[model samples]
Target: MTASPEIQEIAIVTGASTGIGAATARELARQGFHVLAGVRRDVDAEAIRATGIEPLILDITNPEHIQALATRVQGDSQGRAVRALVNNAAIQANVPIEAFALDQWRAMFEVNLFGQVAVTQTLLPALIASRGRIINISSVGGKVAMAAYGPYAATKFAFEAVSDSLRRELSPHGVHVIVIEPGAVRTAMLGRAIATAGELVSAMTPEQRQRYGALVHAVNEQAISSTKSGVPAQAAATVIAKAIAARKPRTRYTVGREAALLTMVRFLPDRVLDRVLAAALRPHYPKLPSVYDA
Candidate 1:
């Protein structure tokens, strides 16, 4: 029931300037779809233009941009049907909830969850017409919350909820929704996180700094270690490509060794998993400020 190539099979990939998004754009282009890759900057657009993917200036968090992207795509889609929508745009902040600001929380969700919802809503008609697929790129952290990962995990956890509801609502209409959860993919984002760990702590107030010092160090160390050992962005992209082309895809496609392991971990009893997680993060525990400490 998928749209045929004669209809100009169009695929929109957001956040396609680099990492999994870029890889997915290239992979989809290779699969014969006219890939409209969304990038925030003209420089990024210029870089990918040579690869045959049309660069679109889209900032998912911006309503105007989202509307424009929809309008522009709808126009270019005159002879085509939107065959796939890859929602790969996302942002991550690493501070714990206690240290995280409200604006930070809102901003993260704006890009990671709300913005995607807007895109999906605007494109649902095209998706329904083409019997197209919607692919959401989540993270291994989406499966389970970890120490100092609250802000990012909150958005992703909510993403899963949104994806589940969306899948149910779209399935009857022949439009499919799939979630791809990747683990520790080596990307510019990871590189920046590792290189800029100090900045996170530096932003904290004196008391907050003292409270999160060792914990931040531990988390960043583990993050760097994980990124160094992480899967390539192309691996996740290949899985996404397959999912899009699938006649009957699974509801969720968990990619990478870490993601598979996290899936398995989901079955553990709450208490058992609680103990395991606590033990794992014990080495990173810093002295927390308390009444007694004061």
Candidate 2:
């Protein structure tokens, strides 16, 4: 049973439990698209539904949840194709690369990179059928890897690659892949990241602390202060809506002015960029003792 074009205008948003995902879900709903809000908690699902959007219990990293979501979306679409998929779920680990454990790296990828890929792959068929678009929620970190943010930025770097490859591969098939790279937009994630940094510091061995304690404290405090002046989550959501509706959306979009400025860093040579980064982080980096020191 072929569904009508109007019936196929459905949008699925991952990580609708909070932040930009929640804002996107609300925005899409307002834009007249039938939105499937993917959330992990029952409470979140209920709250999202109250806004007249359909909320599905989803944990993108959980294979069972992913499979279940695929099935539910298929059945619920009633032969209609799914229009858009917003891969907006991500997690952050903010420790220095040297202090990072393999498990911590894996944990970050599990939710940030792998989960996004899993959700995109699982629902690709519906997207293909509808000639839809894939909106990936990335970060300014995708273009610039900061000192203590290396691991988290690495995930976004990989994501930029994935989106580029997917966009090239899907263009001929009438599917559009767009990456949204946002700078610090206000969200609960920041506070959680700050708290997580403290946990990471507490979990460090005495030797690890000696090497990274100062840098970690400096980075966490800076992150907290920066969030105070970030753009609202809805601002990013508005850009997502524009991307979805544009006749020819760009391959990549930097959501905020700061993000656009950050993306320009790619034009600089690695050596030049390295010097700039070193200067920015030097104040926070621990000073080593010289032979003349007491």
Candidate 3:
């Protein structure tokens, strides 16, 4: 049964506290959808509360929050059909695979990958009932994993795979599952990642530090440079909105030129790609004393 013309459709965006998530929530609301913006704190909830946008306290990792979100959607007072679910909550840290502890790796996956899965699973029933869209926010890292981005990239890669599988499975059910691959967007996420990397570097043993210290520094510098030149979160949100609104949306959409180019070249031979990535990092590495200089 189709929703009445007067009933506003609902769109849910996780991680609506900041960056792409927040921008998408505002954009969706402006487009006339009643957006359920998921934030983790009361402060964020209050900040995002506005006309057509209702903020809910949601930590995607918490089962209680997920269940509450499901209940809220199912029991909407207006009986609005859910239109879209944007899974955007994620965290990142730049630490080498060897230096990152196993528990830390698990923690990253719990939020970045598993949390997203849990949310999607909970909402699939409503999404399928309404023939809605599921938009997964991936990254350029989903296609190309640079040095010191192992754990984060792994989660994105896994998400990319899950998106593909879910898309195929749901296509027959009139549900669209889309993936958005965004390059470095000018967001606070990069600053937080750099700080986390700094903490991880300090915790490394002497041998581990010696092995990965320069590499971590280079990665951080490169990230800062890329973020400075990156597109605004609004640009990504625009793309996401387009995908959600399209009658026949593509399975994947890239947010920026950098994301498009990188995802395109991800098929290059491994050795060649390695050289290219290494060259990109070389300029950011700290200068080292040579024997001649000594």
Best by the lDDT measure:
3
Residues 129-182, model 1: lDDT tens digits: 888999999888788887778888988999999999999998899998999999
Model 1 regions lying over 4 Å from their true place: 1-7, 195-197, 281-294
Clashing residue pairs in candidate 2 are none
Candidate 2 minimal-lDDT segment of 10 residues: 285-294
Instruction: Evaluate candidate 3 by giving its C-alpha RMSD to the native, one decimal.
Output: 3.2
lDDT of 2 by residue, 228-263 (tens): 777899999999989988889998888777788878
Total clashes, candidate 2?
A: 0
Best by TM-score: 3
lDDT of 3 by residue, 1-294 (tens): 222348789999999999999999998888888999999999999999998899999998899999999999999998888999999999999999998999999998999999999999999999999999999999999999989999999999999999999999999999999999999799988988998988888888878877888888889889899889999999999999999988889999998788999997889999999999999999988788321111
Task: Kindly report which residue stretches of model 3 are placed more than 4 angstroms away from their true locations once superposed.
Answer: 1-5, 288-294
Winner on TM-score (2 vs 3): 3
Estimate the overall C-alpha local distance difference test score of candidate 1: 0.82
> Cα lDDT for residue 60, model 2?
88
In model 1, the Cα lDDT at residue 214 comes to 70
Arranged by TM-score, best first: 3, 1, 2
Cα lDDT computed for each candidate against the true fold:
0.82, 0.84, 0.91
Provide backbone clash counts, one per model.
0, 0, 0
Q: Candidate 3: how many backbone clashes?
A: 0
